[model samples]
Target: MNDEKISVDNRDYVGALASGLEVLSAFDVQHKKMTLSEVAQITGMDRAKARRLLLTLHALGYIAKDGREFRLTPKVLRLGYAFNASNDHLDVVQHYLQSVTSELGESCSLSILDNDEIIYLVRSSAAHRLMSINITPGTRLPAAYTSMGRVLLAQLSAAEQKDWLARAQLLEHTDNSIVDKNRFVNMLKDVKQQGFCVVDQELELGLRSIAVPVFDYQGKLLGAANISTNSLRVSMQSLIDKYLPALQDAAKSITAHAK
Candidate 1:
């Protein structure tokens, strides 16, 4: 994730709290357990500052120290649980996503745009795996490359889209990834008009996915709902003709049910 600060100039911003949260976020799937030095290196903080924050978190029961390495404790789950409990609509989303997964026998996911990435909030997986990594809630993917990302991006206003396009780094993740800025902008326009997006083997070699914007009862965009499958297993045409309707139906259901 990008380490760029969003509102440092705000008078109410607490630098210490933000730094502590950043330190906590540095521990992910790749860096589950890390020494003080490792944490300092990943967060770009000096060893002394990292040590103080780690000790504070350890005292607060968020981190556990084993020998020389520190790892997150199960208590960290309370943070996630608090988010889930606060959002009453997530249960509805999960139910409909699971329904879609069962109907189509493919992985379904809901994600919202966070900075230049899409963070998964809910997922329903099929029997088959689509990617090498395990994609669960909290998984982050590049917004410029994924179908759900494009769908969310399409919902942005023209000026906001232009600002995003200016800062986004268009990298080729695979042979099929779109790198041309003009073509990408045109594609976003089409996604905005069509109300859906389909990405074919862009993020990974064999992954194909389709996505549609999901909203609440007030027409507030909740996120993007997606169905992902192996390219060999699902054709592009089938995704539009079959999966698209299923996803659109789920989105409508979410809007009707979600507060």
Candidate 2:
């Protein structure tokens, strides 16, 4: 039933397959492209094993080799696509996200908490760029410093939050980032009480975002919906006064139709 039990009951589980998946996941935002030895180091696998896995993935079209580096290919998108195909609610969420973007002329997104990161499931981008990094579906950001991340984190119970923070190392990405675990916990408590979260240039300079939790008709948590804008173009008061309501309304609309 628990993760430990599942790990122990690995009679049907294929360790090699799991290691191959680990090699795939090791290629993240920071490690976008890596050499064979780098891959082996990250995955803690022998060089020969890593080389075999990388070649198999490359042959399967999931990865592409560029000079000495190997990066995930467009074919890798099929994995994320499979998730979208399985989740009908993502389509409904996307519709409302488009509506939000149309009304506010800003980027809107829906993201779910995945461990210490928030994975964007749906995004409707405005014409202007909001962050130095491109925002898109499947983008992952640190959950400790993102508006949607906090909103999703607020949904967790206190003990769960503590357990997560025990393992999470809050590296300071910016001076505005909450690096102290206790302070971040307090911030989540505030988000829980308010039913929303506003992060102001904490994750990235000049980037501000506000988010509200999304739920199904039966009140099951779906995800968090957020509006991302440039801090220079939008003030904190404006975000709370203008974008927050729109984000909350969109979340409500998505919840209504999600079921």
Candidate 3:
């Protein structure tokens, strides 16, 4: 099992529960509704196991079955809601994110690192969209290719960051994307020292962003906050000189108020 190593040293881990959640996660935006066979293939599980898990989820109201196709139900939203409800600090982050968007006339978002991706929890979008895909709350983007992801990664310990780089599948999203592991690690070190990160059209052709990590009252990492814009409209120097100061102030305010 992919998660077996996670539980290897921890006796409290429940592999079955982990596998069940893995099965549910297989049904994403691209695979909104899938058959048992499709779910099995995506989860790397056998048909019988996948069927069992799906049926269990269906019975529990987390999934719905329409003939041979299965899709998630509204009940599944409780899982994500539970996290948001527990983290009340996110409300503070969202307030500051909206302020950044209002001041800069660009999109700003708050995201947290999840596995190898950064999941947006709060997003204040501008009238103009920067990418083909609509980026809203719940959108997940590759952490290594995003400014917000790099800011969060910069918060990790040296050994943790090194391990992530060694295990990550470096895909080049664009000509500017950093695919070299050593180079990316070095960039993370620079981000750590500078207290911010800038990704210039690395993930999407016209999208450029700058991010800084936000901390809680106890200096614990809360998440990353970023301002995103189209490269043609906003020059890199403008981002550093004009927008960076505003973002940094917002981050400091968010951290101070995060209780």
Best by lDDT: 1
Residue-wise lDDT of candidate 3 within 108-162, one digit each (tens)? 9999999799999999999998988889888889999899999999999998898
Which regions of candidate 2 deviate over 4 angstroms?
1-5, 29-32
Question: Model 3 clash pairs?
Answer: none
TM-score of each: 0.94, 0.91, 0.95
Off by over 4 Å in 3: 1-9
Which residue pairs show collisions in model 1?
none
Clashes of each: 0, 0, 0
How well does candidate 3 score on lDDT at residue 194? 96
Q: All candidates' lDDT scores?
A: 0.95, 0.90, 0.91
Clashes of 3: 0
The alpha-carbon root-mean-square deviation between model 3 and the true structure, to one decimal in Å, is 3.0
Cα shift from native, residue 134, model 2 (Å): 0.9
Give the 10-residue window scoring lowest on summed lDDT in candidate 3: 1-10
Report the backbone clash tally of model 2: 0
